[model samples]
Target: MKLATLRRWFSPQTTMQGKIFFAFGLITFLSIVSVTGIVYVNMRDTIKHNAVTSVSDSIRQADESLNIMLEEIDRLNTVVVTSKNTVIDTIMSPNEEISYEWFQEQKRITEFLSVLINYKPYISRVAVVGLNGKVFFTGGPWMDRTVLGTPMLNYMLQNGSRHAYFKPEGAADAITVGREIRYNRETVGIVMVDLDYEFIKKTYGVKPTADSLLYVLDEQNGYVYQSESAPSSFAPSLEKVVEIKRKLAGQGDVMEQKINGRSYIVVSRLSEYTGWSTLALIPLDSLLSESTRIRNLMAEVAIIVFIIILIGSHQVSSRTTLNIRRLRSMMMQVKDGNLSFPKTEIKTKDEIGQLYRVFVSMVDELKRLMEGIRNSEKKKREAELTALQAQIRPHFLYNSLNTIKYLAKLNGVPNIEEVSGSLIELMRGLLGNSNEFLTLQEELDYVFSYVSIVKYKYMEPIQVHTQIEDESLLGCKVLKLMLQPLVENAIMHGIGPSENGGQVLIRVYAEDQDVLIEVIDNGKGMEQEQMDALLGSLDREDAASRFSSMGIRNAHERIVRMFGEPYGLSLHSEPGLYTKVEIRFPKIHHAETSAQEVV
Candidate 1:
């Protein structure tokens, strides 16, 4: 029982309330989860990136300052070697001897070097050594000749007037720059500039926190410098250094490394002044501490939002289902045939409101359809009753005419007997039930009887001319009483009303897919308005009251009803001339066997 209840609750066929609640809740939950996941990932990356950027920028500025100092030292050397005084040239010239001119040039060049050393505080000393065994110096704390004779100095001289950075074996934290001197396209001597390399440590020491470490590595040489507080072994391994060099060769500027099982962010920059790399390593734990706190807060806020969404979705779904349930209940009442129930009304202009309005309209239409059906059934019964009543009149006339025939025969009244005989035959034709259809020959015979009676009743003589175009068409079937009424109407309205009596013409022929019968009379015909009114009334539902002879309208309606509108009566007339009534029917022939048997 519990399983069945659960199935019903979760089924797709369940109430709209459950579906709406489940849909909205699931969507909200999924949306919140997706947004939270994306934001969490981006925030972590952005935090780490900002930390890396700060460290890289610090190292970059230090590198730029170091490069500028190196360039300045080179510039100062260039000034000494290319000096206008030519102090070294005067002293080492094999072309000239040491004289007053040479001494004055030396004094002037020494004073120029002194001025350069004063302006650049980073430069510890500047010296010029001549290959001819002569040397000039500026500043104190001089070094041995061996320090100047390092292989780097020889390399600079071999490469011609270019500068090279050198670290003397005995100097603790100093870098020397040496350049070759040339006079008149000949290597005369060497110019050397000693810069205080400890300045690099001072420049970066004040920037980083005490915990951060900084180091510089030379590609061809080992580590040149490290912060005083940093341990010598704290540097990355030889393999890591080699990897850093390889990575720095490309566009990669930063790499993440795990040193001694601790994560670190390593940023490296290649110096343009020296073919070396400066690398800065920062602990990942410290960098991500604030990011962790933010993530936790975000998780808490997401949970609160999820709960709020559930409550809001439940409320909205409940309201929506309430309106739908009310509408469903009303529809159920309508389905049970209780249309008299109160109409559904919803003031909300939503789709549900439109559905309710459509439901009401459908119910109203159904009610009207039901009422129309009931009325139609009642009318059908009334029409059948009227047909029965009409049938009695012809039967009574047949009986009365028979009685008159008997009286006229007994009294030897030939005219009265003959008239009553024809009247009786005509009455029988109208009363007989032949399925409302008669053969052409049978209909013409009935017409003869009607004309005989009409002739006896009137004093004027009337002629009827009948021309059958096809003899075989005499066997064609048509509506019964179709011709007799037309003949009677011609006599009463068309012929009898004429001062000079007119003859009636009847024609039966076949045209196209139809058989046509025409009744024409030469008499005082109707006016155009009268003819129009008369012909127009033939097609109307209440055409019975529009004519003196109900027979004409009834006959017209019977032909139309039997064979459809195309096979009905049409009138053409002109005043004081002639009037023609044409009748049309489908060309249905009586069976050959039936006609032969009758013959």
Candidate 2:
């Protein structure tokens, strides 16, 4: 007897406190884990967000700098284009008697070039290509020799109507700005402004860090014009040039991408009048270095918080276990098959103390109920046995009939064969014992079978139809027999007594992350009084009354038990028109085999 008691005590149901502690520890650990994960994720995202913002700011600053430089270049171009016209008009005028001073005029042009060169130190040399293809007012004699046979001078003579042209000075080299000289719409000569390559290189400024770099490209012609004082090969590649052109074609102003292990924010803006684009490249890591340091500090703070929670949880659990031990000793005295509880004196009003009070109340009520049941035990036992027998009878009968049907099919009894075959399938479904939850496919199949039976039974009075949106949802699990009860309710309560034949429509579909099942019936719907009684019975605290309102109430209970209260059934009816029963639950995919289990 002692061994048996020990066996029972040590069974899977034993160590309730230990299991509780394990669960509490697990819950606390998971809480910490979840909070830590959230903190880490939020910190990482914040760092990335700050990084992106920093990159954007850097790009903006670089763009502004580029814009200022381009504006200066445009101002110089305007002066050259307009001043060339003034010089040409002076040379072409028919008023020769008006004191012609060629040396003074030459000095004025030279002085203008000198002043411009001094103001914008970027301009290396300036020259005017005359209408006769002769050069005058050169910045230096070397520039005069170097650009003697350039296409810029030839193109100006050929297409004198073109206003401005910017091209490379030589193969893979500096940029040259050429403006055609015109007076009263007549082409006379061309002014060529040559900017030093070094000036463009210096525009990028100093490298901010080892990871950060800056460069400029000629957008219109798809060529690298300048890069920070790094290797010439570090300049933007041909592919980058193509991308710039494609993006600029659509007026794309900003682009972010990683290249050569470094993240860059590229900003491009077109010159309003000249159509030349100025682009800036800024590295991502350099911008977000400070944010990363702050994130590390936050992580350290989270670690400290976790340690405090751990120590506090252990102390709380130890104190809670001691209190529970005292309560358990009192509970043991009432476990002798007679409900007689000892009065608990727990003063604390926390959940544990409330639980103790509830236990005492339950014991007191059980003793009173047992006294009442003692007098009627024999009669109630007999009735319960009979009911249990009756419940088993249908199952036995169904199985026996299936065996007979199998025998008849083997004997080839043709007329009996078809009837027997259908009967066997129907009986098998009705008598089957399987899992409480099934895949949506299995439930739909069961609904189809039930509908087939109902259609055969009430062919003249009822019509049934089903629609499924996505067949892939067949793998999603749902409560077994969830739909059949609603269909049965619709046929019996909503449609059976109608004068005209009615339709029952079942629709299943997925919306967002939820699986929605709706059973709609157009029939003689229930009056408000009947609906109130049904709904009231469903809402009752008594389990027996709730069970009696099985179809809707049981489904509602099971859905809440499995998924949660938020996902369950909702009933709507328009008396004399229609009734709709809708069920919504989280779409859970069940494993085909135990090895494929998700949780």
Candidate 3:
């Protein structure tokens, strides 16, 4: 019975919290273990691979350094050989006497040697040995009489081959270069060079770390020089060195080797002048320490990932549920036609914050749509009101013209027939049912007809002038009756009180893609305030009733509606001087047939 109780207590179904915690703990443990295993395996392989690569790189750098030193030495040898040949040629010249002052000749020889030595300090000694076996200008200390009987002269006389000979054995080592000096088709002397061993030592400086080694080897694949830190007897087998040299002769620059139970990376490069090889070795262990550090870092990262997964799941679930509830409430309020919904202010700028921003944008667009609908309905009612007012204006004008005709007949005027004809023409234009847009030519013609009637009625006191350039522009379309109201405004307010009646000038021309018409009157003009009241009416709701210039205001509205605000009527005036009304409209092309068909 006790055992059964213990089993039940440990069961996952004991409590909901216990079940959830158990599952989370099991998942977290498994995830950590799996990640750690995978990371450890990959880290081990990567460290091995990286160690090999680093050793290879170190070997290559060492090889390059050694190769550069060898080339420099060869270059110095060439200079010495060339200078010696030139000296021999001078001595063997047919016109030159063998009895030439020995002091002057020796001075010239010493100067050449000084210049060569200054430039290439690696040359410890430079000497010219005559065919008689006598040394001249020798720079190194003489050992004894044997120095004059050195085998270098005999070697140059018998074999025409150059020698890069090394000393048999010494702590202070040296390399000897011997060459026969030829002049005018005959052998004159021998040039001998002894290069200091320290030159090679300084040229190939110590490697940066213990993992790397550098050394110089001869053509026979024997070690002639090595770094101070290298083993004293650290020579690889001749067979192995030969293989390395062959592989590197005209082939790859790097290779691998195992020397004395330690793995090494090796690189070789050939010397251009002497055909000698330079070899470098690098150990593997030192190069892989960096990879060990990386593996430790990976282990730490796996632990951190496991901890984050455990904590993050619960926080994400709780926050998501709360934000979803808030969003639902916001959407319900918006569906209830409450456009002024309160904005959400969650400080956490996560995915939920982005969603809230999008919701705000949608609400703003919806409000703009509702406002547009209301404005559209208001415009429909206003248009109906305008049409009603339009119908009433003609009736009032007809009754007034009839009264004027009866008054003329009662006065027994002899021009009653002409007055009646003008009235009928005026009424016809005012009451005409034409399209809202008319050609510039037609509108101008209407204005001209009205001017003629005004001239007849007002007598010879009033004068008018009209000037239009590029009559071809007359086909361009404009709002109907744009000019008539402007002309009437000038006549009533501009010239009504003038003692000597004013003159009106109407000019029309094309400027770029717009038509410009200017109407100017030399009469009593308005003040700035009056002009502002006239133009400002377009933006005002009750502007039509506030201003007495309804005709000008109506023309302004029609032009703006047709071609946009950029092309509209503008008025400029100075009190008691002049009043100018300018109208601009987009250029419209009318077919030739249409222009001719319009009366």
TM-score of each: 0.41, 0.36, 0.42
* Candidate 2 to truth, TM: 0.36
lDDT of 1: 0.75
Model 2, 170-273: lDDT tens per residue? 44344556666777787666776666656555554534445444444453454445444544544566577557556756856666766666666665555554
Candidate 2: list runs displaced more than 4 Å.
1-39, 42-52, 76-86, 89-105, 138-141, 145-149, 154-174, 206-209, 212-215, 224-236, 244-274, 277-295, 301-599
Error of 1 at 85 (Å): 2.2
Minimum summed lDDT over a 10-residue window in model 2 is located at 590-599
Displacement of residue 276 (Cα, Å) in model 1 is: 2.8
lDDT of 3 by residue, 189-252 (tens): 6666666778667765545446467766765556666667766455455566667667666668
Ranked candidates, highest TM-score first: 3, 1, 2
Which stretches of model 3 miss by more than 4 angstroms?
Answer: 1-48, 66-100, 120-214, 231-240, 243-278, 281-599
Which residue pairs come into collision in candidate 1? Answer: none
User: Better model by TM-score, 1 or 2?
Assistant: 1
